[model samples]
Target: MNLSTQQKLEQALQRLAPIHLQVIDDSHLHAGHAGNTGGGHFSVFIVSDAFAGLSLIKRHRLVYDAAAELLPSAIHALSIQAKTPDELK
Candidate 1:
């Protein structure tokens, strides 16, 4: 029925077929902040072949496009580290 923000994010990112993926909820770190209303802050660490040949901005764009529906509501801020598997070697 209802999924947590992390779950939702993970589900959304699955489209990338990541070799490794981690979603960290950083909402608590910004607790009581002025701009924080109900949305959560998150960090994403992902490794996927999809990132190969893509620039940093393009990689982030892909991530953002996947999670577009959650922005400014289910997700307030997102920090992403996207890398290709080869880059990890």
Candidate 2:
């Protein structure tokens, strides 16, 4: 069975043990865009110890890897904000 996009993303990123995580589906805001072909647009904000000392690009890659299965299929565009808990201060 296929999980919803948000559920899939949450399950995937659980590996990060995020202290804070928010996933917002923004598909309605992009209606009619070429990439909107049924896939959703999402924005993610995450804070996790696993992100400590990682560069922004590395953090993003980690997030992307977690949700790799959703890309170009259930997800069209993703806006991400990944940070270590300490960085949230």
Best of the candidates, lDDT = 1
| Sliding window of 10 residues with minimal summed lDDT for model 2 | 31-40
lDDT of candidate model 2 versus the reference: 0.89
Q: What is each predicted model's overall lDDT from 0 to 1?
A: 0.95, 0.89
Model 1 C-alpha lDDT per residue in residues 30-88, reported as the tens digit of each score: 88888786899999999999999999999999999999989978998999999999999
RMSD of each: 0.9, 1.5
lDDT of 2 by residue, 45-75 (tens): 9999998888999999999988888887888
Candidate number with greatest TM-score = 1
Q: How far is candidate 1 from the true structure (C-alpha RMSD, Å)?
A: 0.9
